[model samples]
Target chain A: MKKLINYTPSTATRLFLGLLPFALLLLVYMGASEARLAENPNDRLLPSLTQMGDAIERLAMEPSKRTGELTFWQDTQSSLIRLLSGVAIAALFGLVLGLLTGALPVLNAWLAPLLTVISLIPPLAVLPILFIAIGLGEASKITLITIGIAPFIARDIQRSTQQIPTEQLVKAQTLGASTLQILMRVLLPQIMPRLIDAVRLSLGAGWLFLIAAEAISSTDGLGYRIFLVRRYMSMDIILPYVMWITLLAFLFDYLLGLLNRRLHPWSEGTNA
Target chain B: MSEPLIQATNVGKTYGQDVILERVNVDVHEGEFITLVGASGCGKSTFLKMILGTEQSSTGSLLLNGKPMPNEPGPDRGIVFQQYSVFPHMTVLDNVVAARGFQKASLTGLLFGRQKRQARDDAAAILEQVGLGHALKRYPHELSGGMKQRLAIAQAVICKPKILLLDEPFGALDPGIRADMHALILDLWKTHKLTIFMVTHDLKEGFYLGTRLWVFDKLRHDPQAPNAYGASITYDLPVSQEGRDTLDEITRQLGASRPTIPYKETA
Candidate 1:
């Protein structure tokens, strides 16, 4: 038999190993919930699996009292819409700014310092100002996420573009590529994976901004629901909402990873 | 010789206080392979860059085809640096085809129908000439040093630039690979009728390849204004008849011509 230290596990073994910690956590939670309920059946802090399940079923299956629409699904849809819109806008702007700054010296000199200053400002600190300036509509929330993440994405892609060897630029020029052609053909294809990776990295910050905006001003969103139930001490709903947000984030990350692999296998292992 | 293809008259380059090349004068005619050799900070590569229009001479004019070299890089002047000459992200075939695609078509045309196909075929044929026919799908990093240099050469000349510049293109290859690259380069030069300018550190490589050899060195030194000067073409020897007798004489001249003053660090 191979020694455990040196032996590599097969995929099936790895999958089982991955599940072991979650299994342990479930057992621990079940035991603690049972003990807590025995002591006081009215406890809300540590809701049991049954209570959480009932909460989820109500949110998932039942309609809201005020509107005929399901609250949970409505929240998911609104949050996702805000997130995707913000991210799309940020990605496009970042790509253009990064490309321009990276390719041209005059632009780099003028804009790079400004971008640095902007990126240095903590995005959350500007949330109040954004709300004041843009108002409490969908524009404010989406703008918040865009402002929170776009500078970071731009800075990352700019560095990647600048790191491209000078020889490639000269060669492209020698090949009759004009400035615009070089950007679209040489720099664009090369920096695209870097952009996607940058977006993936900024997703956490994106979510933070999205949630903060929703919590402060929005009517319908995952963040609005989570914060709304907090006043009522609805731990059942809050915990499930938090878990669902994590699952959604994980799903988005997984999909982006899949796209990166499928579209640019050449860039594997080099970028995030 | 018919009117010189390129003329560099009193060309000099300098930073604020530091000098790189000064008062360099040379004329290159058609069908001449010129090789530049010098010490590390002697501005051989800088001269090549100036001709390619990536770098500007602070002082004089460099004329190509009897016109001042353009301020920007264009399809007429091609160059292959030591490495990183080919885009790492592109496959060998795509790297070759990209030259034609950019040259012949606008962005939209290259993306869609007949232009793209034609570019691909042209690129494939050029790759075949460079002996990279089988490795069309391979990325730059996947190739050996020799293969990468070959790919770079193919990419540079695919547009059929009037002049080709090489900067120590085989410096990183092993000796065996370097010899293969030398043969390949010579073959390409003869077939394409390219007016070539190459820079190499190896004296023998410089001698073996060039029809004209340029040796850059600081001939004069000023103790008070040390940084106010630059290197120049201290020796220009025509080696169109590159034989053992000619190389032996040039070797003696090179040995005798080594700078007596301690060279300044200007790179």
Candidate 2:
């Protein structure tokens, strides 16, 4: 059970401060738009706005119409597949690199320069080169996202693993635990909170990279729809699409936050 | 002759240029309760580490039951550190069962099976011994300081180690809790016949619990940088056979300055 918060405004405060300014702004914008519509009665902007409004209305009327109802399901499906594959590959590589660098100072020193150079190469900068190598396909996009996010994950996990308490390790050793047992039981459990945090953070990074990847080269998908609207200067369509994407991003963040809270209850008391 | 359970001969340690201990000899008789009393930096904790095989001795050798000490720690010796070293993520039951996993009592000796009933039973019995049976399901964070120390003790002794090394085990508790802990430990020692080696700054505690007291006085060697030269045994009193007699002698020694006589009979 959670505590409730009171946010009601006093009657005097509400009467003095609320509603008037926002009401006025809406009216002014509608009046200006009406005046513009009178001059250009058959403008394409009006039709596009109507189309976007119609889409929203249809979505509200029948939510299932927006569910699994994209013409580019194949492309979306393939993109999803590539994204999951890339995550798996990147996670494996990142874990290996993290373990090597974390356990051995010499390995860390050797990889430091390389990792720095790799991190500095922004995702956008490499899209063009990746297009040349893999030709504007799933490979190029997935590779770009993987390379962009893996370093962040690797660095986070490495630090988490290294921060395991020395006393705990000594205690485990004195308990007759073998190296494998110590790693599996002591080291892994201690690092789990940080590892889960890193994974959630990386998921956000993955979503950002997904949008950027789609915008760069794709005939369909959410990012392609936004890019298509941008070319025609259809601000109305663009705004609604941006709102939809923001809602999706918000949902992802919320779900991940709920999971983090459930898994690490100790963190919530301090953080809240 | 009954063999010494723990024989540390000429045990010494050094941290770079500074020597913490040198030529320190200790023989822990089987089932004998001993306390090593010293000031800070007397290397008492370091000596315990050496016995536990967590830290290497610079010189000399330590043997357990006439067997050469292994390169790594084993279940033959259990240790309770001054700091509550129990695993915070695990329940009290899990922490105790962790060390017991390698023992023969494991289910078909398989690594992962339903929790071994016998091990749980054993852990429960030991927890009962430590008066922490009701805390079986509680995490380390849920326990108080004294309870945490008791859990640590339970965890260390669950495996039935031949020798139990405690380094200031109750030093962190409050006065009331500390006294309670002292009595609890003494009771456990008597019932289990555990060869206990404890390090403490509390002279009264050392006198109350230890069968024999080994005092490390720093002021005896160098008054200015007293801790530089490793601590020497300033007073070695036997308290096992003569508990009251020993207490009176200690009181007399405390009152008298440089008393020549070793033992004084109580009227």
Candidate 3:
């Protein structure tokens, strides 16, 4: 008998297999939603597609009845700004600290032990502390995401730096490079693509911290609006908001992947 | 003669309780091609590291240009390892150009405008010499083993260093390709006037390539403490003058007891 490992699927068959689960999921959801709606037209638990679409249009396109402004867009903008600002700051600090900690033993001695403890602490556990210290404004939310993921990113970069061949470092020095020049010229370019990979890995945790911070103490954000509409049991609005967040996460991951491929063609398949 | 381009006196290296190399002594003048061969676990590579300045000798002094060799790697010496010799992120041309960056540039190791063009031209010329002229834009991973080694040699020599250190450079190459690399290295040695130190497992290769052949072996051993005595240059033979003394003796020493020696295994 042929071994299971030996049976490689054709590309077309692989594509079909990839989409089968999602297709099955959607079909099941539609059938369940139909049965619920047929039983009770006012059922909010599983609103029909049209109902959800109308909710999305109301939230996204129309101005809110109370505030005379588009609440959905405002929430999205503020959330994106806070998330991006926090992630950007984290990535910058992560790269610098990682490169230093990874390349220089002096800095590694000073920071690595502390970073281990910081990375282990749950960011949500500090939500109350951040809100009190940085206040209820955007600072607290941004600080939450940054504090949540910077250590992981820094640690990843440090590991990647250490993985570089000791031979290469010696070669660089033999070519008349100083310690700083070796770090900037040799290690920096190599570690940049690795840093991007690390950031992509951290995005899930980043979003978690962002949403958790918003849910606890925020006037606006995707999480804020979800909690706000939960008081009325508005499943229609909640469903659409969730799908929107998923779409945004998928888009950002895809764009960042595309950016990595474009910026560092040689790094392709390295992690593979 | 001319203060010997490099001089080593009672050079030794050890860990906390284990000796790796001991009492390595030799004087190498300019344009000498020294090929080192030994059984596995011998300290030939460690000696190379000491000369390369990454590993300082635990005792005694290694001198270059009549002064004690710098404790860190400097532009006067270049090395090519068995693998990972070239930067994966750089194209064949850029790999050599980066050597120029280390040589002339300050902190950033980057050039601009006229300097960039000049560096590129110099790199291209060296690449052409190494037979990588057609693959200048190809990254290291895209190249085959021989081509990558060629690129390594080019990068190592581009800065016009006085010494070129190669550690089993052609060990991974096919026999035919290894012959080609031998010719290329010999041609580069003469044209560039480089004093070469190459480590090879193949006895024939050391005889064929080097003006002098060094055999690294431990003359004494303690059964209780395996690493009590480290390897030293047991026999330093000038290949050009005395290669025919006895090839059989070396093959016996490296092959009879140590059946696992890389050269005999492959041969």
Candidate No. with top lDDT: 3
DockQ of model 2, rounded to 2 decimals: 0.22
Candidate 1 fraction of reference contacts recovered: 0.58
In the range A1-272, model 2's lDDT, one tens digit per residue, is 43446666689889767887878866776676667777886554433446567755543444344455443343346556655666666766776676556655688899956876776778778778889988987788788778878887778777766765555656655566666676566655555566556666777677677778888787655666667767977656565666666665567568767876677554432200
Name every residue pair that clashes in candidate 1: none
Judged by whole-model lDDT over C-alpha atoms, candidate 3 comes out at: 0.88
DockQ top scorer: 3
Where in model 1 is the C-alpha error above 4 Å? A1-28, A269-272, B105-112, B221-229, B240-267
Which runs of model 3 end up more than 4 angstroms from their true locations?
Answer: A269-272, B257-262, B265-267
Query: What clash count goes with each model?
Result: 0, 0, 0
Candidate rank order under DockQ:
3, 1, 2
In terms of docking quality, how is candidate 2 classified?
A: incorrect
Candidate 3 residues A182-237, lDDT tens each? 89888898999888888888888888888888888888899999988899889999
Q: Write the per-residue lDDT of candidate 3 for residues B51-127, one digit (tens) a residue.
A: 88888899988889889888888888999999887888888888899889988758878888999999999999999
Model 1 Cα lDDT, one tens digit per residue, B1-267 = 689898999999998889999998998888789888876778898999898888899998888888888988899888898987887777898888887777855762154478778878888988888889999999877788788889989988889998999988888878777778888889999999999999887777888787888888777867788667799997788866656786566556555655442222112
Find the number of clashing residue pairs for candidate 2. 0
Write model 1 residue lDDT over A1-272, tens digit each, in one string.
Answer: 98889999899999999999999999998899889989999998889989998998898889987887888999999999999999999999999999899889999999999999998998878888887897889998999899989999999989999988888888889988877888888888889889989999999999999999999988899999999999989999999899999999999899998998788776753311
Ranking by lDDT: 3, 1, 2
Angstrom error of the Cα, residue A204, model 2: value is 3.4
lDDT of 2 by residue, B1-267 (tens): 577877878777777766688777777788877787665666777777777777888888878777767666777777887764787767788888876774543222224555577787888889888888998998777778899899888877776777788888887778888878888888888877788889876767778788888865432455465445664455666766556665566556544532343222211
Residue pairs with clashing backbones, model 2 = none
